[model samples]
Target: MFSCYYCNFCKNRKTTGPFTQIPNPKSVLILPKKKKKNRAAHQYHLHLSSVAAGRQPSPLRRPLSPASSVIGAHHRCVPVKLLLPPSPAFTTVVAFSAPAFSRRGPTSFQISALKPEEEAASVAKAQKLRALQTQFFSFHHNKIYTKEAVELSAKLLEINPESYTPWNYRKLAVEHYLSQPDCNPDSIKSVLDDELRVVENALRQNFKSYGAWHHRKWVISKGHSSIDNELRLLDKFQKADSRNFHAWNYRRFVAESMKRSEQDELKYTEDMIYKNFSNYSAWHNRSVLLSALFEKKAEGFLSKEKVLPEEYEFIHQAIFTDPDDQSGWFYHLWLLDQTVTTDSPLLASSWPAHGYDVLLVEERCYNVTVECGFNKNEDLLWKPLSASNSQTARVWVAHLKIPSSDLHSTVEVSVGHSKGIISTRGFEYSHPSMFSFKVHVQPMERDFSQVSVAESISLREENFMIYGTQSEESIINSFNQLSIKNGHESTASNWRSEALAKEIECFRELKIGKLTLARLLMACDVMSYPFANKLVHSEEVLELYSDLMKLDPTHYQYYKDEHSMVLLQKVTSSKESLLQHCFQYKDSVSSAICGPICLRLNNLSLSRMGAFEKLLWVQMLDLSDNELQSIEGLEAMQLISCLSLRNNKLRSLTALEPLRKLKLLRVLDISYNEIGDHSIDTTRYLCSSPLSHSVGSESNKDETVTSDVALIDNWEAFYIFKDFNLNQLDIVGNTIADEKFKSVLVKIVPKLKQLDGKLLG
Candidate 1:
């Protein structure tokens, strides 16, 4: 039964707590009205059997098990203030709905979450060593739990009840501990006593450390305790800050604990309602309570046990009376769902096996799974779930629709193995490689939450087939169409001799900007090395550090560019320099200039780059025809991300990287390259991906010396991967994808999400 008392702010008024109504006048009518005479029949052994259509209770009573002993379940999340007690972490009470698929059968989710060991010393030591982070991550990945941890923690707190650290540590440590799996047989009784004592200690200790008190209440409320103490830990933290949310939250926790054991929950419920009915947090707590009651009542209905059919009706009446009260709704749902499903965690590698309830804790994420049990050969569909108390549930339906095509099959999976099925007929192309850096080389890959996680395998590029530019190819065939269109037949020879001149002009202008190549590089983006190496003579590309430096005056032994100072250290041979540079400021250049740098930087090594890259690999290269047309795949390469085809007779824009994702390509001076407007216009592939930022690599150098950051000489339009510029789109080296500039035909352009030149043309 549930009820909602009146509130002025019912609409804007967020409510809490689970308030179920007790049975009243509406209930008795369902019974035989031998009325006054039958009342005499209720007198003896027929007590509970009265509802069974007449059965007698066995006089023998059984003792309750220590672990399964019920304090009863609350269907809704209690208000933060009541259930958790107000604390800094108890920000506000908010209701969330769980995904509908959270039901499952007998199989518990196999999780590798660890149970942490206890020790006042270890708690402090672990925090200091950052072992908790490491250990948590380790267990999270492996899905293993430890029983020693649960026993050790539960035991340590009993010895020193007032120690808040171990108590809290124990709380975090036991998150994944299932009752039977983690419980220690030898210490079960002592552990229960210790938990109660901790709560008692928390109440005794000025009764105000909200963190300590709230934690204790949660521990005791799990139903392992018979004692419930509610006290005000007066100004526990000495009012260094009076509005401490943590302390205030704890006060709320103690209030909810009072309801742990109640023969008549209404009296306590009324007291709580009157205590601070206006306190929304408390109201939220009430909602969870009501929800739990609803679930219990539902269990009775399912079992043919002692149940009040009319009483179930009363729960509905309360829900209608106060539509916004969470407690009532939660309880009503609980009674409805108990037989339907068990709360199960998701099969992802990131989330915990426990913590599936959102309102159950202050968390950022949750995982849920759902399963449908059926007779053999029946299709899995059509199940009922009108009732349940879940705030954060994610359901994974075990049974699913058959594939529309005869391409693949679905099989049950669990931990210790992964989804490895692949078919030639059905495959998704966009999924990233499932390589992991972990020691195991499992044949299957994890596709769930593990994408873009911290566990992917690290692969470096291994081989190359770099080729260089040959002399400018025949002018007539390359420039035929463009020459006729622009009336530039007279200037055809003129443009062929001018590409290097433009490169020289751009370099000389940077000098006029009062910055050398070093200063410019310090401010370079992904183009740092490629732009600088372009300035170096090509013959010196293979020169060793000492040998090349002795022969070239233009070459320095070593100098910092716009990367990290650590990068410099990594490039060097001296270990002492590496260590010394670590302590310097990130603001200044550290090393003196020295180097005979590689000048023969070429393109053969580049075709095989990875999804991610550092600027060190950039170099000048020629793309003649290692199967070349457009450089579309090189979109992310700002300097190398660009390509030059002065000699190749390319015909279409298909060879270019989608321009939308490249912000670093500034020099599209394919002046002497072969191309014509007849090919296509430049709007094929575009995107909104984040572009690389211009990092001052010189500043990245050890701060022992100072260097200024300067970049582009005469370019005003810089491309960050996010912003797309059409004017910078150059199809000079190749024929446009279309013969008639089809991109301009559309009257109003739709936002370009994706454009394949072949399709657009």
Candidate 2:
């Protein structure tokens, strides 16, 4: 018997193995290819069989079906293995071939099998689709936007609506068609609506698909929009998710384009807020609508004298209903903010009185100069009214005393700024009016109003110091009368008493381990009530603030600072006592805070002079914008690091010599001062002497006894702090000439890495 076995593919025999070569004894048979895709399976079979042999195999003689082969030829070789019978007399021959089957070959159009016939059909369809996609993309890349190109992109978009590239190509295709000068508007509108539908359908499939939304916006923006319908669509989107800011933004755009009535928009926002007061977007939108609605009204809630009490009620209701809702509180704040304003100038009485009178003026004015008729021209002392007030407003007071016999003296008043000065046209001797000592006090706002009111009262008390009990009683009576007129009974007899009561109440709450909103509000009201202009210095307030520090550690410094401010206000004697008190409580207060508050203390009364030596532990000191003539007291603070003396009255670098002992000092800001650096002796320590060793130290107390040398007359004389390790030095806003400063200062301060806020090379 003779038997033959064949494979779809064959390999050449490189070496003889196992089977013997056979002579021609049997006929050969080849099977036909089944179908287009199945031909690849046939080719794979042939290739496998050829590899099993050791010789180079011949290629398949038959052609492949169209779908499997790109070049219309079979690339695989088929090999046949034959087994010959031992004798021809026992003749029986059989041939066996491997099973015929098909595989979807690895190509761009490849599809996994489902059913045999289905997979073949699917693969053929995918191949045609891929070819079509390639042609379409090629046309798009080449900038072809013809009708056919548009159709192609439409089909691509149908397959992948979220694909940005296809959407962009589609937009380009439509735009190209519309760009033709002869294009009719109706035709364009029809095309645009169709494009809109495409995006709408895409959105229906995937609502949050960015490309679909963007394309819809683009289509509408090209003058094809029905804004009313667009708004309705956006409303639906927002209904799905009320907090969707994007949908809200789109709705706003449509509403604006359609010129939606402000009232209607406001009502819409109100509806949204009513649904969810915590929705920040709705609240924010409501605020915008309210502003727009109120802009034209003279007595609008956010405008002039006629404040919107109803708006206030609404906001208050929202906040009270949900205390945790920041949106309500934020809107409430916006409602309370001041609008555009007019002018009110301040009037200052004699220094002994130190009283301020705010005068209503038609024109805005800042600086006021008062001149009393005398033998020669004299300028009175004048400054800004307070730290928080505008610089344009000045308080002018003089120390001049008028003789009893010559009580009627003419005075000239002028108010102006950098532009020049404008004086009253005529000088006159004026008599005091019935309302001379009375000042109108407005209702205190929330939060810091207490501090402001108290500070004001403190100023008034200081001004009336010389008048004794009668003047004090008169001022109290004036405040009482004003409060009665305003229809509110005076909360306390006076500013001090009211402040003390607030302090007590704040402490009582702390003792119970509670700081409720009601209590906090009551504290604010109590502090701000009765129109007091005196500083509260209650120990209980300080203690309450200390307790608050623990409860709200994030604002610990703020509480400690308020505590320090309260204590300083109580310091009736020397300013050094304030510094001492601050130092005593230094464990609770931060170092940087003391300086500005200390400056405020000095400005409050201007009655302190001494070494700040007792404040030994303070590290950072900001003495900016103060009336300091010298830095003589800083020697005691050896641990000081940052010192800001900007906008001061120091005239020479000699005042800075005390800083030499402060070796830890690094940042020194003396900008905007009148200090000069003309050659002066600068002391440099050859060795660091212990802080204990004063100038009086008796180590062989004779002339030229120590290694310390004074560099005299050289520009290096300004280098006293060379050993102090000063890295940052600010001298900005000074009149120091470039020639003098460059030749002198930079050479001396070689260790400085920063000068006047600029980094040095």
Candidate 3:
């Protein structure tokens, strides 16, 4: 019998022969040729037959089929109708011939039936895996930390390095073995070395395996592996994949353990960065090392005068090399944040213009002490007038004992460390009479001259290159005008401002890095010369963010939030606006009353509220219709009583923890927010009462009540409003506004007289 095979090249094909029974079909190698355009397609076939002892095959003849051809010796072409059969006992090679079949080549592959041996092996492996897992867990549960158990865990880990449970169990087994009474230093080293070798093998399978890396660190921590060997291993891993953060983190750990010099690490980062400027890890590491080196004043590093500029140049080179790379830009922003100074806490103003009985200091201070020169200089204790009664407050009040005779003399008042000379020469000399006076403390001017003249000139030259001489002069003139308007000296030689302006111009011209330009403008506006002046480019920053949203629509939400932050800063930076919006004055029968101010900051799209110290005196603040997700900065509004955070994105009542400090707060409106049940229930508060037990039957009742109180106190909202003295709270239009939640709220706030605009029964 002979087997016949057909090729797919023929449109319609038929073959007939007695198929030979082969022991194994998979042993046949079928090489398929790749199809090419405009090539002759041909299919080769192997023929087998059996003949009598002396029989000879027929001689070669002319092509029986017009399309068929014979190539090798002893080969013959037969007609398609011919059907040859092999003897049942013996098979012999007959000839190679072509037929109407499809073309195939070495590139093609065939899916054959799986052999019985392979299928059986797969099942056996699965069974072994199950058995190993069963034994491993048994050993773990039984606390069997023996050599056999350790070997079983090793076998399991070899199958899957990501199995963290096995890795942990193996560590425990090693530790147990080490703690044995028979174990010595040598034995301990040997065991640890074996563990390290196991971890090494696992890492070889997967260098990025978290479990393997963690185990390696544990073994190294046991003082088994040498630092040099570990470092070399890290070098190999990092070289293979430079952006592998796991390897980089492990390298950092090893370096710290070895107490490697920061300068050396910094050099390593530089080398990595030089090899691949797009590597974010290398750039981030470089930033960290550079900051540390600068702080320590490390030798062979750039001096303070050259540090920023040189680093900026390096970053610019990288950015210009690959305009799309974001690593350099991020590092640049980090450097700016580290170097630039913003609005730090300082004494801004004091009230009582001349001589008065009470002094009010408006500044963010942890402690304020007033020393008056009236009765031979005395340091009077100051108290925070803010309702929070916090030590660190924005408004501190102190009372002074004014002498009738000294009212017309020069008196000096010292607030904290800042001193103000109050001239009482023109005031009436009245005994025990209070008078209103105001003193404004000017923030010290930043000396731009500290920046070396040579550096300034170099920066200016670089600016001229980016923004041509004509444009550079225009920017300088514009900044100078802003400085003069804000009551600051000219920025003709302000190197920092000039450099920032130039960078902004370059980015604007290139029409790239919208975020980068916005940040640069913010830094320049905040850290401009004569730091006391108003922000120079806040409006520009806002507009740039708007452009960023349009340019990069994918990050529209982020840019919008940033825009809100900048707008908030701009509004708060102006003390005049803050006072106008927050303070309310009314005439009384006997005296003028100035308190319980109402600041309506509605519909500002504010995501974040900053400079809360400025709003410390505001009592009724409405921050409705904003994008505020959290109320973290509201803690400084210690005097706030009526606050409306309505129609915002607040997702939980726990975010209102900051409001708990407003001890005087009475009315709260948190309606139409994303507050949900999960957030409400998960909110926890620490128990304020100490754990104690009493004796007697009455004590049992008290203890039971105490336990119930403790359970209720676990909810943070209940704890926040326990002593709030709140008369009204509005939580309408929220997920947790159902009747059940209302009942829960009533329990949390017992003093509530009204709930969601209705009087509570």
Best by TM-score: 3
What lDDT does candidate 1 reach at residue 40? Answer: 21
The TM-score values for the models, in the order shown, are: 0.21, 0.37, 0.62
Q: What lDDT tens digits, residue by residue, belong to model 2 across residues 1-761? A: 00001101011111111111211111100113233332122111123211111111211111111011112122244443334333321222222222221111111212243798887998887787687689887997899987777777777666556567879888888878888898898889889988887876776665555577778878878886565678777777778867554466566677777878777888888888888876656766776666556564423344433434456557656655654444564454344331111112212111111122222111223434443333243654543321122333222223444344543444333322222222221212122212222222232222111112112111111221122344334333332322112222332234334333443454354332222222233243333322332333355555666566574443333334334434433452233334332211112122222121112232321111222312333444546565554454345344456666767655555446566655566667777766554332111211122222332332233533134322234322343444446677777766553445644555566666666656667
Count clashes in each candidate, considering only residues at least 3 apart in sequence or on different chains: 89, 24, 14
Ranking by TM-score: 3, 2, 1
Off by over 4 Å in 2: 1-175, 198-218, 298-307, 338-761
Report, for every candidate in turn, its global Cα lDDT versus the true structure: 0.27, 0.43, 0.54
Model 3, 1-761: lDDT tens digits are 00001011101111111111111111111123234434333342322111211112222111111121212122233332222222211112223232121111011222354699999998898899899999999999999988899988988888767678999998889878877899988888888888887887888776766788888888888875566788988888898888665687788889889999987898898889899987767877776677667756688554544676677778887877865554566666665654453212222322232223222211234543344565553665554432223444444444455455543444454433343311111111111211223333332232111222122111111121123344334333322322112222332235556666777887778666666777788777656323353667889989988876674443445566667767866776654444333422121011222223356677888776654433454556778888776565465455556778889877666557567556667778889988873433222221122221211211223433244554364454554455566777788999867887677778767777778777767
lDDT top scorer = 3
Which 10 residues in a row give candidate 1 its minimum summed lDDT? 1-10
* Model 2 alpha-carbon miss at residue 351, Å: 18
RMSD of 2: 32.4
By TM-score, is 1 or 3 better?
3
C-alpha RMSD of each candidate structure in angstroms: 33.2, 32.4, 26.9
